[model samples]
Target: MPLFRAEHGGAKARPRRRRTRNMEWVGSCGKTDENGHVLSLTRLCLLSLANNMKDMWAKDYADNYLDHYSFRYIMGPFTLLPGELVEELTWLLCTRKQMSRAALHLMLVPQLRGLSLESCPSLVTATLCAHIAARCRGLRSLDLSGGQQLPSKVLCETLCCLPALRSLSLAGTPCDRGVIKAIAQRCPLLRHLDISRCHLLSPAALLPLGAPLPPLPLISLLALDIGFGEQEGDPAAAAAYLLLSLPGLERVAMEGLGQACCLIQQRQFNRSDGFTDREGVPRLVELWRDWRHRQGTDTCRTMREAAAREEEEEERTLSDGFGSDSEEEARRDGGPNCSQNQTEDRKRGGDLSDDGCLVLQLKDVKGISCDFLDSLSLACPNISSISVHVDDFENTRGESQGSLLATGLQAWSAQLRSLSMYHPGPLVNLLPALQVACSSLVSLTLEGVKIGPHTPLLEVIKACPGLRDLLISAEPPTTPWEAEDEEDQRAEQNLPRLANLCSLTLNFSYEHSQMKPVMSCMSLEKVLKCLLAGSPLLEKLSLVSLPCPLNGILQEVLDLLHLHQYFFADSTNSPLMPLGRVQRVNLLRTDVTMMTVRSLMQRSKRLKYVDVSYCWRISQVEWMHCERSTEVQVVWL
Candidate 1:
């Protein structure tokens, strides 16, 4: 396992998995006994184990490992105990490995949020939660999912300590109905709460859900979820009118939302929103719930699951339309009138950023004029991370594309160490702009962006030597040569080659010129001499569109090249070189055979990532007949 260290003063730690036992013991102790006989055993025996476990704590090495951006976590016995748990917890909340950790946390946290850990099986629940609650002061979101060992009292004390808790997940938590109501009242600031498997929750347990508070009144709650039995009590009524009293909620997700669909559909609001009255309210709660139940059922498992939605849902209304909640005093606050949809958008936008880092999340702002973006740039100067999605979204017609503010980007590139942009044109256009505008653009990603003519992109890349992620579409150069004259030729010659291409993918769609083997024996002999170069730091490569060679071409070339032992009979094709520090290369639609792969393995000891999708020839061959590529990841799709 390899740990990748990023410049953000963070690193990743890899997990070492042992398969011998359900609980494999790994300690930093070495003991030798000739007869393998113990004289005596007592609490002293376990103490030795503990001592050995404690000895494995090489804090310096662990700290170094924690400094990386990505790594696989391998648990050691010493690091899994109660005290050791604290150390592991501290290593993450306080160290590097943050990029990879953020990636993993983002993936799991959504599912883990609002879960109760009274059912966690791997550790002593009460002791673990108590310890974590005491130390993890930064735990704003908790997952007490399936926490089988955490008793109600442990949860109560821990819940009180977590004043900053914004989300609580009690799915499968063993707390009784009484405990649920008490905790809800205690933690009124909670925005999201899940009581999913409280096969024990009742309306009485939820009455405290709307208990009033004093002075500022703690009315910041927003979301609540609960699972319904085939025929449970009125948990639905408790959530509906109960939330109305607080007067401040934007979104909610719950199971068995079919019944609540009736309430929202019958309620009155507005037609401009396609949500007459409260008709659209049900859509918010069931969207996530629908995704959860539809997982693996020919439906989307993710919420922003736009990729899988085949069609839009129909609309219906219950109550009359057009009015504010004058019933609540806070609703009477004076403000210039805005469209209800704009108000809803503002409410949703204000949902999470209070404690989290400042963000520039501009998505689907249809026709946002240059002046609008410029104004925004002036407002959020503290933003360090940005996610911009301008989909077919156009600026004001006739406005120069240059008018949209790049000030925010320029500011971010200077202060930010992490940048992720998702736009086909802006990403490519901004590359050179960023290089010229900011001195430090270390960690940046340009995903799914169409970079026109490879030359400009190459120019930008060369300019930004500090770039760590240059992910771009593999489209071939639209204009391979710009040399109308000698001056142009000289400039083209100065451009970088495929050698420095750290990660590459040859566009499968573009015009692909065929790679014919050397015509003569002499030329065939020279293929081995052409050493691979310029692939330093190259971990992944895809050679797309190279069709399988004809049988005669394959055999003749193999023998002509003197590849009697399949492709690498000579010393030239030995597997000892990893170009540009590359660890792996994937062959996509290539004509190369297993023999050629064998030559690759024989030549490069660092070989990894060899996968073939939709290839039938390799599927039929026996392992003995086929030469194996000693690699880390091999997938035959």
Candidate 2:
């Protein structure tokens, strides 16, 4: 364990002594003179020296004793010494361990602003709370999470005394409604409150214990995180009460209150009948019945049919070795022509002028409508990136007409540089809309979404020319065998030129267990070489949990540059791998060997970090072969 050093920045703690009339009063504290200014200095010294510093001192005196006379005579001479010349004092040791009543009294000071006594089970007595409330009057933040449980009265008194607190964290503590009411009544300036694991407190106990008076204003909280307890009782009511109490709150994070969040937003946005129900119960049952009457059990059948038609059209255009009319129509609608317009776009330098970004993470997408995005765009016009994460993508949908693709295209497309959607529901209109609108996109991450599952992933790559980072954590389509004597036509197709690509992460980890093993159908060797052909500036690559032999993966990548030279012999001047700037490679949970790792390191001089963890067959001795290479750090399982 590391030793705790209370000295700030390796400097010894000095007894601050000012040269004034107060100095003499502080210095002459223990001297037993005829003026009665001293109280038996020799006897006090003998008593202090002989005793083991037991808890005999008054709590008030012990907590504020540093401002008194005893410590003045003990360490006042060290105040004249320079910082570098001061010797280390072994008697004064301070740590975060549980503080006895005497210890806490001695440590309390007016200058202290922050205190973290987390998980100190020994310091849970009511006396400690009373001492802190009396002495540490200037504290602004306190973290007593996971500490010893306190009685409701002591907890109430402790919180009520700290009216100047700006932040208070009491997670995993025992408290009742009375203590919470005391805090609400006293700490009117409190901005953040976290009562996450207070299991004894229910929604009924959290109903804004104090109302705003004429002179005193209501507390304007910036954030409140209250969830994850055994007795949440009625989360919707609690959330509603918090919102009604703190109307100006900016963020509210609740772990087990997703349904409540959705309900709150739905009521706030869709106020047709003012969302009035008899017992505050929602109209979800009525809405479900209405939806079932409108649409049959096959809810997603329309979406599937639309996607199948689009896929057949895309495949027909690819098979004929020509572009479709829809592709030209998309270009006319503002799509960037990857092969022809990239040179001019490169000259212009793709950089977003705005720096602001908006992030939204949702557990349910039932209440998110296109009007919501429109309102957000109007409110925050300079938002440069919009990231969306949905918990259950396959079933998430809006109860409105405009689809998710329409929102992406019509709202802030010219300013967006990064678009990340995890577990998307459907993509029949997404690619076409993106190609027509978000041309300046620099980073795209689509995890657990099927893109070109019937066509090819190369088409999706070619649609965006300015992409710098691409992470596709989804499986592609298996090449279809047309005839017994023929092969899949897509096996030999070339990839689009993405000259600005820098980082790529393709994780097919779910395929090993979810789908049948069919590595031969992917034609991965040809596909990989095609994908890496124009991305010469690539720096980081992660092929995590791929169920394939990793023996020739690096060799195939290294040979791609030479193949590019052969295929495009017209130019013939581009350098080998052009940038050759690959610095990190993560092949975690793959079948990679040490020999393959060494070969990759030998090829890329700038390779710095490689994670080949969980390749159990590789020997420890083989790990030593690359240990001497200073540029690379081999991560092991």
Candidate 3:
């Protein structure tokens, strides 16, 4: 039996020292000293020592004690009492110019005005601008953010350098735009300014910056997030448009943008009768009956037709994708290009900019709407990689719409090659995303979600022929909600055929046994006929549990592993029967290890590493009997 331990990095305990003091008249610690001999202050340093030091202090005083005391030795910023003592100690650490290591730390303790130090834990001086504002009076373009406190004097000092100040950021500092405008009026060259999360200001603060000056400078700003907390009083929907209207402004992030996207949907989509824009689709479908009773023939037929059309659409897309009239309505909305991206668009209400770099996330977004591309417009033209979260919460009543919303995010920046999503329903959007430069699109991650049977998971893998890394959660439908649709099953079955796939993980799965197996799987020709399709291009496979063992009925288990290494390693059109290294295999308490598990391990010559815990009830010795017999390591824990 092997021991499993939670790895921890810590300093070893130090030995305790006796706490002693002497007045030279001492009989006991509580006894008074005779002759009234007073204790020497210098001696107190040696006598007033720590007890039980072994518990907290480690042995090597400098190596362990001082090392562990990083930030721990000095009480934090709050503990420093305001006095000359602080300035004296700070000077002691700071004046040691020879000790370059201590200079930055010495400066960090001060809450002085006009100072800044971003993420760096240590800095010799505050940011260039803040330092000058504190020490030099003639300078513009100040940046004093993230570090020591910002007093009004320092803020006022920096603001004095206006018109020449083209770039200024007072982020996380305590200064308002009123003070900012007082400076802006004097400085006309202001180009870039970021005052995000400044609680004391409002949009009206921009008035001074907006006032025109000669040279008619077109100062473009990257972003502006200045405002009060969550209720930063809603900007006119035209605010962003108006800000961009400024000649030089290209990008702006005013609030928690992701949350703002949701809020925008809530506000514009909210109807007075306790209904939302998306909820209207189903309401419209229901209205068919009302219209029929009211004898509104044309309207009733259209509504009836939408209900009929919706029935044929996939459930996963219902919540997020087009309803029966989705296509027709979009067409009327001037979207004649639905055909250009029908496979990718899951939900409506998204528009791609002419440059395809920007996307306009539109109103009434219920799920991951095509509207997601709306935010793509916010990114710089050069960005090619991104991480996105489409769903923050589950909407069980609108699963179809949720999926459509998630899948509709296919509209992407031309440069996109890697994408990650967390908590979105129907991860199938990966299919449409793959269409944008298939072979070049390399890395992808899907967290806290599942791809439905209707989603072309297999088709996506096949299309991304050169894919190197992939992470996905496969939770196959557990119950048969409707009659089994063969085309849906075919799409799912094709997933495990990605011969070029390198890394893979099925975080978890709820897929039923009824789904057909992969198309390339040969041995299970008869058995897999019932359970055929799944992911195949996996160098790293992590499955919490497998309902079926790789060797038992999932016949492609060994063969797929064999094919993957051979195909990728040889880089040949012809199949190489003998494969190479299985770098890593981690299986946690899976059911597929009963029969062929031993044989599979014994045969995989390329199998260099493995972790099989609570699997097959097989012993380490039994596993060692397999092909990787030359060397073996096992940890039961």
Candidate 4:
């Protein structure tokens, strides 16, 4: 009976034995053995099982496989010792793989230094928080971006427990002032924090005024992103308050459109173009500039007296036992805390130059008056990049505002390299500023600015000699151009200013065009030729919202006259051949055909990425059937 049983079970027994033999074993000697492997608890097997585990969703197959009883025993003798457990688990599950709360719980080993739980929906739960607190006690960096399911209270509580945490990201989390205050009090060692999109957070939570409550423990925070959120308090006041409090803050990003809406709603403030009672906001900005500048200037006797008053107030707080009593005296005499002593020394020496921040990105300032811009530019002299939205000259009904905006820009003339502006109205008055002020400007973006037939885009390009990147988006001219006169005008127009341009984007809105494809295509080719002639080093060209379809007629016209070769050819054999180095062409939101795209791809050897997105003529079937021309990546989504 035993012999018969062995014969029947041989089929399964043989494979099981072979599988065990194939498993690589790491014994106590720290050497791998395949053959002579003992099934003792001391030995571990580096399991290399199924290859199909990659197809599974959420849970990483390797992590799941490692979680198996036999595999866990092999890789780690994860013993519960008395001292802290150290594990280098960074990037252990960072491959766009989602891990469940249970799986995360299993992986949470004590003494984890870094952990990134980005995009994990189940990351913030009672059980998970308990696991993190108990196991990940020594974690230094924690990233919880896109975890919207995480409750603010739970998040604050979890973060408060991790005292050693240095970097934290609560981006997209529904956190408020309470959470911010908790972080300030609990996470004193935090060096970097991202609270972007936390709409409920009040600015006062970060910089409480009236009397400094023993000074915030978040003095170590170097970089902050408080961008894109609806403020519960006045943002301008909050910004000033923050600058006065956090002296060590180096980089700040406060780009949001909410403030603009509020400003536009207040029509009473729009009295006159001239600086008057109507210009109270700009005056406030100027006052803020003075107040901030006075923080470190000792030469000014009046400012010194104010500083003396503040110091005395702090001393009074110490006498009331609210401050660090012994440390307060030591700080006053300049004993320990070298950073604090240096701050005090700078205060006494009237040195404000070192107190300026490095980068300040402020967006959606269209509702903000030019005076505010002026004060910002003068106040933050050390800033290298400034992004602000200014009221258009057309909407404001005067050139003075545009001139004022330009004048404000001159404050950072030497330091400024990149300038981005969104002008909802006409930009005619603002052109003079670009022409003379921003000489060191390397990149310029002008969006939503109307350009009539008389608009001198070429002149704007000419103003910045060092300008390498230029983006201009505007509605197409309402008055249709006379086809007969356009050719004559093209012959006289010169674009010598675009010689240094490397990237050019000319986006037009088709909402106002009255011309047919035949006329529009000709006009497009003419404009392209003109721009290409001027930009010899141009590498990226995006002609978004084309007025006509790139179909058979356009292809035939180019083919018959051999214009395709001149426009797309690598060599400068033809006089009309543009010597420009264009590598990518984006024709998104147009009516481009497969044949036209194929021809363009075949001719331009340097063209690598061709985006014909939303082009209805190029069907999905046709795109799939089309041959890959010149290794070009044609995107037709």
lDDT of each: 0.40, 0.52, 0.42, 0.53
For each candidate, give its TM-score against the true structure: 0.38, 0.45, 0.37, 0.57
Off by over 4 Å in 2: 1-382, 389-402, 424-429, 451-456, 475-494, 497-500, 511-517, 520-527, 530-533, 547-553, 559-579, 589-593, 614-621, 628-631
Please state every model's RMSD to the true fold in angstroms.
21.0, 21.8, 24.2, 15.2
**On TM-score, who's better, 1 or 2?**
2
Scanning candidate 4 in windows of ten residues, the lowest lDDT window is 44-53
Candidate 4 residue 244 C-alpha distance from true site, Å: 0.4
lDDT digits (tens) for residues 1-637 of candidate 2? 1112133355655656533222122333544432244544433443342243344433444555534433211223222432221111101211313245444444444445556565454565666676567655666777777654578788888888788887777777786678677877887777666666676776545544323431123332211234333343354444444443343344344332333434443443233113224224334334323333323223235444655576677667767878767775763454333323434433544211121121222211211223244444432345455444443322345422224444534666676676665554334434554564447788887766643334345556767788999887865434432211225445445456678888988776443343223343334444455556567888888876554455565666666644655666665464647326678888876666787788677656677788876665466777766687555888876
lDDT minimum window of 10 residues, candidate 2: 85-94
State residue 77's C-alpha deviation in candidate 3, in Å. Answer: 37
lDDT of 3 by residue, 367-438 (tens): 122334344334333334445555545355554433433343444334456656565566564455555535
Candidate 2 has what TM-score? 0.45
Top candidate by lDDT: 4
TM-score order, best first, reads 4, 2, 1, 3
Worst 10 residues of 3 by lDDT: 358-367
User: Candidate 3, after superposition: displacement of residue 540 in Å?
Assistant: 2.2
Q: Residue 504 deviation, candidate 2, in Å? A: 2.3
Model 1: residues with Cα > 4 Å off, grouped in runs: 1-373, 391-394, 402-408, 424-428, 437-439, 451-455, 474-493, 497-535, 540-580, 587-596, 615-631
Q: Which candidate leads the pack in TM-score?
A: 4
